[model samples]
Every structure is written in C-alpha cells, then in structure tokens.
Target: MPRSIRRRPGLAAALALLAAAAPAATAQQVVIYRCTDASGALTVQNDEPCPAGSREERAIIEPPPPMPVYVPQAPAPAPVTSRATQAAAATTPAVPERPEAPAPARIADADRLPPPPIFRCHTPGNDRYISEDAEPKPRCVPLQTVGINGDPSLGAGAACEWQYDRCERIPDGEACDGWRQRGREIESTWRYARGDARAPLQDAFARVSTILSDTTCGLPPG
Candidate 1:
C-alpha cells in the first residue's frame, strides 16, 4: 500500500511561533505530526505520531536563537618588562576608562598664616626659659665669681647685653596647644593680680587668646 503524503502548512507555522516563544530552558526542538485516517480525514498535533496503518508526515520547528547578554569588563593590569624575563609586553588592548576620584581640597601655608615664633633661651647661670616676645628685652646678668686670686668673694660686676637665644617656628598644632596653655596660665594669673599688675595680665591673656582662637597650627581646614 502507498503512503499518502499530507502537510497542514498552518500547523508548521503555528508550531514555529510557539517554538520561538518557548522558554530558553527548553532545549528540545518542536516536532509537529500530520495524520490521515482511512476515511481521508486529516489531523495535526505536536509531538504525536499517526496511529498504525495511517499515513503520516513530520515537520520540525526550531526556536530563534537567544540574544546575547552584555557584561562590563574591568581594565587590564599593567605589566612590567625585565631583561631576563619572557618576551616583553609590547602592547595591550584599550579598556574603557573609569571616572577619576575627586582630589582633596588644600590651602597653601603662606596663604593661611606663618607658624607662631618661639625662642629657646639659655642664661649664663645655667637657667633656661622659652620666650614668645617678638622683640625680647635685653637680658643683663651681673658678673660674679666664687673666688679670684685665692679670694673667697673675689669680684662682682654688672653688665648689660642682649642675650642670644635659638628661635624656631613651631608647627600649627604645637603652636595652638602652646597658646591654649599660655592662655590658661594668663587667666590664672589675671585672677590673682590686682591694680597696676592687672593691666599686663589682661594684655598677655588677650594676645594668647587671639592666637588660640585664630590659628589651626598646621591642621587641615575643616
């Protein structure tokens, strides 16, 4: 017996549409079967074959390829070349650039202020002290000797000259701290002094207070 070849054109088209809309997880292709009974009535169904003794046809429907997903790639690290190493890296692929981070704000030291000046003083008698006065008054010490020419109290004399002292600019932090300490000491003394002595204490306190409040000593600006 000769097998009748029949095809329902719409069935293949419909199955193809379904295959395209199918989930990507479905890896199997769509198979459509066409069937005809002995009475010559035609039927079409997916994934079903004709009954025994009936003519049949098969059609395959393939799903459309999935679109490729996009992903960002990081820049390649720089390679260093050496005289003893393998072939030196000549060139590398260009990579997408990233935004640069913002730089911190800054102000020059000269623009803001100069550090407070402090002097380290040493006296002839082995006494040491620090001075903040820009124009220090002349310090004079009397010449004294325990013995001269076998005399117990040989000679004593007075002389006047400006003492030499080492001066340096202190860091802003240290200067700020020094000014604060000085302010505290000035306030303590101001509370104890009275009448003529009160005037000098007030002046000293005001000077240190200004230094403390206005300078950052080398600290970054907020």
Candidate 2:
C-alpha cells in the first residue's frame, strides 16, 4: 500500500495567522537641536534652524584601519667598488660652521718700557769742589827758574809767596780757565791773583790743570 499524503488543516491555519500579523511604523522622532553661534556662544531650541552667522559642518566619526600583514623584503646586496670610488664615498659629512675666535690681544711697548738712565757723581769735596774726586791741596807752584828778568833770586821768595797767597782769596765770580778730570774725579787750578805777585801760584795751577786734563793721569787723592 502506498503511503497516504498527510495534510493537517489546523497547522496550516495557524501558519496563515502568523503570516497576517504586521509590525507598526514608529513615529518620526523630532530631534532637539543644539548649536553654537559665530561668537562661540551655545544655543538651544526645540525647532530646527541653522545657527546665525555660523556654518554647520557635519561631524564624522572614523573607524581605525585594519592591521597590515607584514611581508619581509629581501636583504640588499653589499656594494663593490674600486679603492678610489670607496675613498670618495667615505668622505666625512660637513660640520656646522663655528664662530671665529677673537683676534689675539696686542700690548703696547710703552707698557713695558725700561726706566730712564740714572747717573750720580760720588767724590770727596764740599760745595766748593766740582765733585768729591778732586785734589786736596791748593794748586800753586813757585817758578824755580828765572825768566829773562835781570835776577832770578831778587824777587823769588817774596813774589812767589804773594802769588801763591791768592789761592786763599779766590776771586768771586771768576771761573778757572783749566780743569782736569780723571775717572769720576775732577781737578783744576784757578788764578788766585793777577800781576807778578801771584805768578808762582798761577804756574802751579797751570801744571795741576794739565795733569787733570791729561787722559793718562789717574784719579788723585781728594
């Protein structure tokens, strides 16, 4: 016997009821608007109106990008070159320019000049002597030999003594004509008197003056 086709009426009717049920549409929801004015002041109202003097730009939310699949690249080959080429490639990178050093200081010679020459005479003489180094005795001598005069002995001692005495009375404001210098010492015989009376002393002063001026004569006793 063939299997009879089984059909349930009640099950078919329940399926029809389920197919007839329909969902209702939700009411158009009013969106309360909120915005800021051009001066950045906040504004809120029930009705939708574009904010005054401010353009409205739509705000967008972005999703993050997907993670990338990593694929390793092949290693680069080492470079091969001639020695000259390698040397050119090996040049050091340029360095930043540095400020120039200040110029070396220059010192003036006046700052290190030597002191002036110092010279002082040291000899044995009072205010009268030219310096400390001068002969002590009066420079006078008697003329031993008579000149073309009639007699040498006649006017000899008296005239000689008178002439030499002039040394005791050296004339004021009269400078001696001759002077002798030996090393730092000076010696000189000045005319004490005029006329024949002082002839001997004058002759003596002349001799002493000569010795003083002589380069060969050494410094005499003070």
TM-score of each: 0.34, 0.15
Per-residue CA lDDT of model 2 for 149-200, tens digit only, reads: 7566654443222111111222222212213221112212222244664555
Name model 1 segments beyond 4 Å from true: 1-130, 145-162, 188-195, 217-222
lDDT values for all models: 0.60, 0.36
Total clashes, candidate 2? 8
Worst 10 residues of 1 by lDDT: 96-105
- In candidate 1, what are the lDDT values of residues 1-222, reduced to their tens digit? 555555567667766677666656555677777788897777786777788887788989777666566788998988866855543334544342322222323555555564476544445556645458644566664444545575646655544555654444445446665565556666666666767887777777666655544445544555
TM-score of 1: 0.34
User: Cα deviation in Å at residue 107, candidate 2?
Assistant: 55
